[model samples]
Target: MKKQLGNNYYNIISEDLDGEIYDLLLTDVNAALFDYSDHHKSNKLPLKSKFKQFLINRLFVGFYLLNKLKKRYTGEMIILSNAYIPLNVPNSVTLLPPWIFSPKKKSFANWKIILIINQLKFILKERSIKLLLSENFKFLVDKFELELGNLFVKFKLSAVVVPNDMAFFEKLALRVAKKKDIPSFVCLHGLPARYNDIDDNRADYLIVWGKGIKELYIDAGVKEDKILTFKHPVYSSFSALELQSNLSNVLVLSRATCGIPCESSQLILTDRSTTLHYTELVKENLKKLGVNKATLRLHPSENEDFYLKNLPDDFFTIDRSSKDDALNQCSLVIGPTSTMVLDAIKMGKNYILFDPVFNGLTLEGMPLVSPFTGESFIKLSNSLEEMKYNINNPNDNISYHELNNFLSIDSNDEEKFLGIMNKNK
Candidate 1:
């Protein structure tokens, strides 16, 4: 496909077809697969009938109505609420939903007519993308452009901050901000899983947690100047606590059964049988380490019932406390390529990457990157023998230098955030 379309492939999907928007909505195409364009032929979405599309197009009416009542944000810096977890932006900055931007218009008829015309133009534009993109994409583009474009015209937004650039409304907001010359920032919430051109700096500035993440982006062709590195508050304010003396309680950071459709080429990476098999193995191994009372800290998306139904009675208990509290309870934490590894280490607990190598790759489909991989303070165990060796010899860990490499806890993160907010001023 790359050879057939050449550079036009990029122009068509990104600009002409608006691939990112469709990728976020439909989950059929992953726009982040720009470097791996050959995957397109295999992942093409089946086309829907024009009648079904017309029904889907009506969803825009609700989207427009939702924004109609939302009062226009009078503040300079607007942070999308979803990004608030990682980026604790100051209270002075007005936080709003990514979709609610356009203010109430006088007449709905005028907007309806515009919507109809845009849908017609979209359906007639490119035949190649007809199967990949549905009328849902056209209406989504119309809804966001109409709303965000209007919001920009009504108020001079100083800057826009979002959790990521891949989501439908978030990416569109950044684009609108760029067109209006407003500074845009992507405050990454967690360690990035994929590093492709489409996943690079979509905003004017990419605010990351540490140098390691910045390097990943840089290695993927993003310029150094485009990224701004800062300490995450979670690490900056984290004072080292004494390791739990009684090593009775244990925590297993179990992964979600399904991958996020928007982020993956395939959704079901590891099946229930595979996940349950690993859970039983973890339980048996814990017993060997003289630990019996262990709890399962499942991914936020997973249900407790799935594990309860499959696993043997009295295998592992469920952890339902807050993340900080949960870490405080467990002296040792075990997981496979999880972001929670940092949390465990920050709380002065021992963390092991219990990665059972499946065909030379971790459970997340790729090998762990720096800080998590290579020589680090954290222990990594790929096999049952390696797991036993690392678990038995708790002192095999390195120093704090690697943690700093992943997330520097020395910087004034709040100050840097304020500077970014006032950059355009």
Candidate 2:
């Protein structure tokens, strides 16, 4: 049987812990655990090296921040730093420091000892799980559980809202809030890319951008009642499509090159080599279509300096402005399956989902769903030839009215979000 790491990890912990701890705490850890096991084709990193990473990545600054900022906010709604709650809700206090900054502690010696003991127990009981418990992973579990539990008590927060349940402190906050009888929610910040039980929602309610995402989650096994659709606050303000005279400059959205380990699944989605290869293909194909120059808009997470130095060719100009500004300048947009496609269409710009087939399948290695899948509504290109075809035929794409069901253009999102949040509060 394929190991359902999240379920398995939870079952084992619930059997031993004997507490009111909700299952959400372990969700993020197991998600990363599954990805980690699939990533390391070779030997595991040494214990010393693992500890160093744990300190650098999780503890050093994080520990200090947690203690320093514990008294900073005492409100009804506690927002985790990574939550990205776009709306300006009342009685909300956002933690400034990220979860990577560890809570202040005299020494990690006791936690390290507890981790070793747990590792030995895992080795004897379940060898498969033992492989998942690296020094860093174990430290994260113990450290966050204790620190976040304390933070919840300190704030006396009645409601918790987060962007996702997949991040360590985010899931931990949900779990901790549940134990304290405080309602928790996930206010989706962007278009969801994956739909599966592995990416299950831990929050009581998942506040989505539209019915499109809500339906996708229901199909993926999430309960319908647990989902509440709210139009994106930003997308609601989308300007009416301005008629353009000609297809001037084309804008290409370039996402960061991330490995399988960085994601929640074992799927071979993107790699450094494949990403660079795809870029080369885009530049070459655009040249074939008589387009000498196009703007390459990098993902927000990407560093401009790094991409400038590493990009295959200087044939393209880098886009540094906001998404709205960039889309306004460009007459035509081409890129992979992303939320940016929605933005491009909202601005009256014709967009082509450039999902070129790499090895008999799309670069994602699987078929995507809805906004990315519905070729009848949106233009999708599986090959370079198709990309050229879609660009030439700009009229063959989803209309402005057709996009309403996905993201409503009405200004009632603020009211909807407030209604749901008030009920929970």
TM-score each candidate. Answer: 0.70, 0.68
Instruction: For residues 1-425, write the lDDT of model 2, one tens digit per residue.
Output: 12323355455654643332333334333434443331232124557766876566444444554455455543356544444545577876554323333343222113333344344333322324443345554565566566656655655555677777765456666777777776777877777766765454777777787776778888987888777766565574344455342336888877444433322434343544455566677888788777788898877645455556667677779888888899888978878878787677677787877766555455656556677765435767756677776776666555455466566523564576566556654
Question: What is the lDDT, from 0 to 100, of the residue 40 in candidate 1?
Answer: 24
Stretches of candidate 1 exceeding 4 Å from the true structure: 1-81, 85-92, 98-132, 237-241, 245-247, 261-272, 384-398, 409-423
Clash number for each model? 0, 8
Give lDDT: candidate 2, residue 21: 32
What would the per-residue lDDT of candidate 1 be over residues 322-357, giving only the tens digit for each residue?
999998878678876667866776777767677665
> What is the TM-score (0 to 1) of candidate 2?
0.68
Worst 10 residues of 1 by lDDT: 33-42
